[model samples]
Target: MTPPPGWYRDPHAPHLERWWDGTAWTGHRRAPGTPDVPPVPPAGGTGRAKAVALTTAGAVLVAAVVTGAVFLGGDDDEAETKTGPTATTSSSATGLPAPSPSTSEPATGVPDVVEDELNGVTFPLLDGWVRPEHVAQDDVVMTTDGTYDCPGEGSVCRHGLVVSRTVTATDQTSPEALAEEDIPEAAEDAFGEDALGQQPYGGLESHRVVKSGPVAVAGRAGYFVRWRVTTAEGPGGYVQSLVFPSSVGTESPVLVRYVFDAGEDGPPLADMDRITKGIRPVTDADSGGGVGSSIGPAH
Candidate 1:
């Protein structure tokens, strides 16, 4: 029997024939009873032509597979490059540009304002008083009115001056308002009853109610008041407290209180007299020539 038009006898098996349609072979089988015939050459030349056609078709299939693989690999590489580690998301969840190069440098310039050596304590030898030794250390400057066998002792020792400036507030109320308001309980714990009173000195015109007294060293004026009470140190201590406001409207004032150790009679009335006299108001165009002077000492 003749085989189908597109069928060929298997070269290796006599009983089986395979189908070779235009393209690849079909692995389908014929019935066992089907007769097998040797393939005949075409009019043009059969074996070589058929072999060449089959070879060319196989080459095309290989090329297609290879091309598809290459295309898939290239796509994977492109995807990896786009999502690689160097790329990052911003806090806003959007991709951001890279940071710029830095050119930072350390700062250098003038120093901070500080007190000079003589800035703290000094006595310029006022008339009718002698500067004493015990309170005349570089840290403390004390001046006295009367004579005493031992310095810083005795009621006849009269007045004593002790000056200290710190960035602390001894009173909860302002120095201008201290005498008028009840003393804060905390102040009594540290400074005692003598720490009361508001004495007027001089102040800038803007501080209509606050007073300022003589700060002979810096030409600053502050308020002065006497606290006739005992201290953490001793009994019968006299404190001629001076308050220098930090600025026209600031709350905290720099206090320079002079503690004198002059018994129950307190420092000679002369000592208080000297302090009141020495306390001068700062004279400035804005001062209004003492319009807001404190009526008596600040409470």
Candidate 2:
């Protein structure tokens, strides 16, 4: 594992810092009180680490960013200390910035994750993402990078970000059934009719169903679908769907929908994956119920 790029406590010295150039430990070391000094290798420990890009995104990176972790040996709890440098400086080896790439820039302060429980499932919301003004249902929790332009020929768009998730139990629902009901129908409205089956799911701004495959949702066999739709705000990213069996009394199935817009910087596929994979049903042993009933709509 490539140690994150930062100034961590020099295991050799109590308050001194060693720069982790996102690869191996750099001979570069810095002391506290001084922010502009160069890093030099401390007293001991040879420096060598096979490194990868610092842009790999996920929970591990988030954890490192949150705690401002130091590079002790990977998986080695022997030399860790509770201290770190408190200044802004980049690594001489990797030239990467302090903090980390996974550090979020949400409207609010950065949080490891903003989480909530809905429809008997608990999941994390993106930090700084704002709640949508409207939702399909109260039980549906919707938040976005920012306000979406009003829907119009060209003015309406989900520019940048739109994250919404909801769980609904019908008489019954399945992966294929939800796809049949939601995908083709929605694409038809965005484009003409059968736009999904007629063409690829992405490009052209016209809505389309691009790809699909079998997936496991909440440990149940399910499916996932990706869609591209036209928006006035900007070209939209993919809207994903996950349908699976509800953890309820073993009858009602659940359907969860996701609409993501990562912004001009491109879709935040990593953040989306983190949130999606974090979903879990509250079991009877944990929450005492199957799935919770809808309260109202998002407002």
Candidate 3:
């Protein structure tokens, strides 16, 4: 049987040439492998064979023309079929070419920041205070000269101090509720009976609502209360507490304490004030999961 338009049967091979009809397919069929070479006409004979030969030549020419036309038309039709209405519609909708995944570009936009990382928050350390060797991960510890002068040798008499704050994820629970139950527990864990001299500061002192300020660690909210206790040692060391709420019922609230030898000549209280006020929340973009440190002087 003759194949449909745009389709051809290769007589020399067992395979069929499938055709894309712009919208659908045309079935396959067998066809002659080679073009038939027509015989030359006789000079001057109106014989029956000559007449038959002429007719056959004309039919061959017509078939050749038809075949060429069908192939050329099929080429144009196939091109249009590949780039037709559906392709245009998709391109318009997405405002880009259809994605050839192998050749596609990576996605473009701002990257997201995680809230739990604490690396972005920074505090300015007061001048003349030396950072210590045993600093905690999220805490910045420093020391200043106090009533006792720096000793010439081992374990100098200078005041020892630690300052730290962190922001961590929390639930919807109010900072007051979390602090009411959790702060005492955490203080005891970290400071033992030394946690004794707890007092309310900010709005928490009046038994009213505890107010929270912006968190330095992202995705958290709360304020810290300041507590003080004097050590029994002769150097007369002092410890100050700073505690704030974390995500409800989860991670512990951030706790920072400063310990130092008590003295009239120590650094001014203004330094501590500056550090506390400077603390603020940090986003993932700022911390990169705490891999890097934030820029600023130590407080």
Candidate 4:
């Protein structure tokens, strides 16, 4: 239930408090222990909650996204019919696409499926993929089997990686809009440069859209934009951004990104289609046994 109007920890700025005026977030903000000021919603009032947050929340989320960026490379796990569950929270906010509140850890024992309760979805682990052992945010990053030294020293990289999270920075719900807006950022995060400023693929140089269109995911109409990116150092890669609405909560927008190294060692691009088809609802995963059902919306 929505809490009564009051100052609460700002999801965008955890160090400060932003007013939650009953039904929506307000522009009024103050530090803890400070005297209260009458709530002053954004100039346009409560209706602008989303617009205000979209404009103001990015400063906080950029750090999270950058920090969570990792150099990609991985091994092989045969596809399995077995299924399991894993939970993760969402990040706070950043530029246009921000993060959300943290959620529970992934349920143990189910390796073939990763459940994101916060976003109300599940991602099937395709052949040669494994769930992440550790991650920086609520991201569910499924990667290929092994790791190799980076083109730059001091780190390892994976050949393929897929990450999913809730887009909490804006009230914008159009999957096509979110997908188009997110592709560049996703490409940069996965290929341009890593958290440490290391360019595992020699830093992204340029990119061209290979595919862009509407697609169904988890039975929800969504959109996807895929690009073939070129880098300065090693073999570049392909990245795609997929945005859809969560099944739970207010049906918030959810973002899923895919990164595949452009080499034979990387996963076959077809796996992208297979895994996308494998996505399902967390409840369905719990009751349906495994990922045999094709529940995602068709492209």
Candidate 5:
């Protein structure tokens, strides 16, 4: 049951104490022994718990932004640290921001749009795609439902994957530089060797740049680099790294990576363009920022 209104360890910053007003975390914080300030009133009804099917819409990319361990590691341990909605209070001491409740009904279906509010953007869910579960550290990720036994032993790999996250690991701001630097690592994470030394695509042998240059994404200027990767084991696919200024917040660089298996088993290469064109600021929906789309059950 939700604990009675009181102070508790701050989930975002364990070094301090924060108030939990019987329903949700509040912005009020204090040192362990300091006198408690009046608790902030809870907002409306209780917020929805974290969804098992998808990450929170406003999930922030705090802490380590990118690490080898985060790329499709498929670890259950990461899920254990995820908490419910963050308080909407403007206090900076509240640690990471909490997600607003999702509008999609609690059903075994896919929403037409998926949001990464922390980065201030939304992604369109295209045909043959669904929100990914268990892909650690990706602020927003989706993949084709179809999967096959990984060429490497002891794991499964999806045929297509798309991931977007803020580039918090560096202070750099140029989208071109960030996109170029991230593609190689993105390719390695998808087709090359993993942390466990498992070559999911039989080890990325080489990559040929298919396209590289400036582009537009989500109404922001961006840059993208797409490569056709060759693997030693399976038919390798295409990988693209696109970086753009976030539509909201500090305008920190946001990275969107795409991976698709080669040939018929993977999503159409055109999907990358479709998805890119479909991205928009979450505020745009009511302002004509989005196109008409249909919601469907997860495949």
Candidate 6:
């Protein structure tokens, strides 16, 4: 008999239950009693899907056109990012021609996909995401759809992505250390020190590491961190980073990351993963160069 729709133990992911979509296994699975974990997307599925996250309140940090410099940090004194939700709206994005092998046939939600030629990375961009006015340095890029006042207690934040083309090193710190400890501390030390440590600017809350564990990015072992941020009263975000495997380079990981801002119109973590998976290294940072190779004085 065809059983009614219900949760059943997943044969693939033994730890979770899989969904039987009447006709076949939908690939939507979860733990037996676990709550809040998002539905597992089916492999080779077709249809336009809005990415969702495990947490109820979460968004991502993105969209841009200008091909600019690549570096992390800025010279300007850190601005005190006000705590709570912002009233910014999604900014219009000037789309770029898809990068090499881009225009991911599978990615649909992002109409204006952006390509970073310098760093050899490309990803989908939300319709109204725009570039941030100022950042710590060129290597770090922050883009977002404006923030807004939410209907409920929290504010809808500017959802976007922050890409750090200049990550210091992968081996200097463990993957867990980089995601859980270093990333937040580094961000705070650079931006949060000013004021409103409780508040967040550019959709970033004084990020708090909520959960972390191992995950794969671009087929590489990595770390993922779910953060409980205070950008809005009830808003939050997540940061997922993967180091280039030792086969690539121990010194640096072509830092692959996703900054999700839990805004009213925020993109879900699952959607973010779809784009991150498309990232393909243009040049092998794994060959010859180890960590911190661009150190010598300019010729």
Against the true structure, candidate 5 has what lDDT?
Answer: 0.57
lDDT top scorer: 5
Question: Each prediction's TM-score against the native?
Answer: 0.31, 0.42, 0.33, 0.62, 0.63, 0.42
Winner on lDDT (1 vs 6): 6
- Give candidate 2's error at residue 173 in angstroms: 3.7
RMSD to native for every prediction? 45.9, 20.4, 36.0, 11.1, 11.9, 20.3
Scored by CA lDDT, what does every candidate get?
0.29, 0.37, 0.29, 0.57, 0.57, 0.37
Q: Please write out the lDDT profile of model 5 over residues 1-299, one tens digit for every residue.
A: 12345555553444566666543344566766655555544577333233111122223222211212123332322221122222232334233333342211111243677665545666778878876544433333566775677654436677887776656535678988887777776777667655555555567688898877776676677888899988777777898888888777677777788888885677998898788877777666433223222111111
**Model 3, TM vs. native:** 0.33
lDDT of 2 by residue, 154-222 (tens): 223333232222223234356666644555433322222111132111223556665566655444565
Per-residue lDDT tens digits for candidate 1, residues 58-137, read 11111111001000111211111000011111222112342111001011121111111112212223444443332211
Model 1 TM-score, 2 decimals: 0.31
Summed backbone clashes in each candidate are 14, 16, 11, 25, 1, 27
lDDT of 4 by residue, 1-299 (tens): 12344555553344566555444444566666566555544454353212111111111122222212442211122110100112111122111222222222234465567666556677777779876543332243577777766554335667887766656545568988888877777777667655455566666789888877776777777788888988776677788888777777678777788888787788898788787777777657643223323333434
**Candidate 3 residue lDDT tens string, 103-212:** 01111232121111222333334566543332211123344533242322112233445444332323423444443433333323222221122211101111121222
The number of clashing residue pairs in model 4 is 25
Question: lDDT per residue, candidate 6, 114-225, as tens digits?
Answer: 4443334444454454544432122223455555443222223345555533243123435555555445533332223222222233333466655556654434455555
Instruction: Give the least accurate 10-residue stretch of model 5, judged by summed lDDT.
Output: 290-299
